[model samples]
Target: MRDPYIFSRMHRIPGYLDPGDALILRALLGHQNASGYRGGAAEIGIYYGRSFFLIERQLRTDERALAIDLFDAGDQKSGRKRLESFTERARDMGCVLSEGQVIRADSRTLAPEDIIARIGRVRMFSIDGGHGLAHVRADADLAAATLSPEGVIVFDDFCNPEWPEVTAAILDFLRANWDRLRPFAVSQKKLYIAHTGIGAEYGAALDRAEGLRRLPRAPVNLFGHTALRVSHRLWQRIGYEILCRMGLGRMSAMLY
Candidate 1:
């Protein structure tokens, strides 16, 4: 079968993920999201499913995995779960489609009832939504409540320079729920592993997986240096942004 993440894996921009985020993702790939003992996997962000591709590599075709997103490329699954029930359709359609358990809705508005009714409790959940105080908080709440007790929550865009508000909300959440939301792994791209688990053995296995050993700086450097070679343009864009932020908007536009 054609790889779903081939384009993204080959073409994502550099500095898009830093050393820490790479480590976190590698470590999360080592175990069940809820805890070391739990089973199954599910992802919430389909920003093309970059992380989805990574985790799916660890599973088989028959593994019960769920992918939830607003597949809103003007595709068919582009509405709330409030409408077409996701499971019944999956069964009728023969459950062999490329997309797995597709839910077309903003996770903030996803109904927990449909989830429990359709796929049962999710083992691992990747929360990459809203990122605002209201939306991110609401999504996080739902993820926490819905995740299996031993499940893990993968948070995306933790250190987005363009969106400080999202950073603030995530930090506040970590502070407020310190015990449940331990910052196991972090980086410039902001992927953190939060284990809401109670098993000592499970926690140890995951804790061991969080490290910087997986980041090979060569790929990104070579890609930028020879392949796409977008570094020059990126530097220019950064300079222009600085100028704009410093009250030189007119000059910045000209420079850009």
Candidate 2:
């Protein structure tokens, strides 16, 4: 049976995550389930709760979804509305709002200790905060520090020309923290990173996912570990354009 939370209802949430990228998220989370990996989830950026909600769906009832964003403090009323909308949607989706903590703060200002104290070690953390190099580096550093063993971190807008700084920051982070984290997979808009010990497992899982077969995979050495990189920009664009035509124009415009 199709999982309503991850597959059906999640697609209805308004956000910039393209269907392809969402599929990647589902596959990674699903793999975690199949492998019995246990830990909470988190996102450094929660705009209208699009990707955040999907991450929430993958959580066990006891798991928390820690979301950090500037919210009304940065985006003003729109950010407030997005948070309100996310709250209502979480309720509708049968998620406990209390378990999903939404913190309004600049991600760059958040220290690793602050996150660890608040949310503990997360298995899956999404970094989609400010696209600037400094901001991305800070978020990445925090994620590396707080991620659990076998946990995966998703970096948003990697290799996207529109946000060149994100790519640069990610590369720098990987280069500096090679022993701590490694890139296992790269979708069109997002890159998946994990601890060196388990990065290969995620890469292998993504390689075997049926939905991601068409996305070309190449084996590469990341931080001395065998990792897989999926570079399929053409397929990503095609799928994203189809989603735009299917009524996600605004979201697609923002993402693409």
Q: Give the per-residue lDDT of model 2 (tens digit) for 106-131.
A: 98787777777766788999999899
TM-score quality measure for candidate 2: 0.82
Q: Per-residue lDDT tens digits of candidate 1, residues 77-99?
A: 55334223333333443443344
User: For candidate 2, what is the lDDT?
Assistant: 0.77
Q: Residue 98 deviation, candidate 1, in Å?
A: 7.7
- Model 1 alpha-carbon drift over 4 Å, by segment: 1-23, 33-36, 60-62, 74-100, 196-256
Clashes of each: 6, 0
Highest lDDT scorer: 2
Residue 195 shift from truth in candidate 2, angstroms: 1.3
lDDT of 1 at 77: 51
Q: Which stretches of candidate 2 lie over 4 Å from their true place?
A: 1-11, 73-80, 213-226, 231-256
lDDT accuracy of residue 199 in candidate 2: 77
Error of 1 at 244 (Å): 31
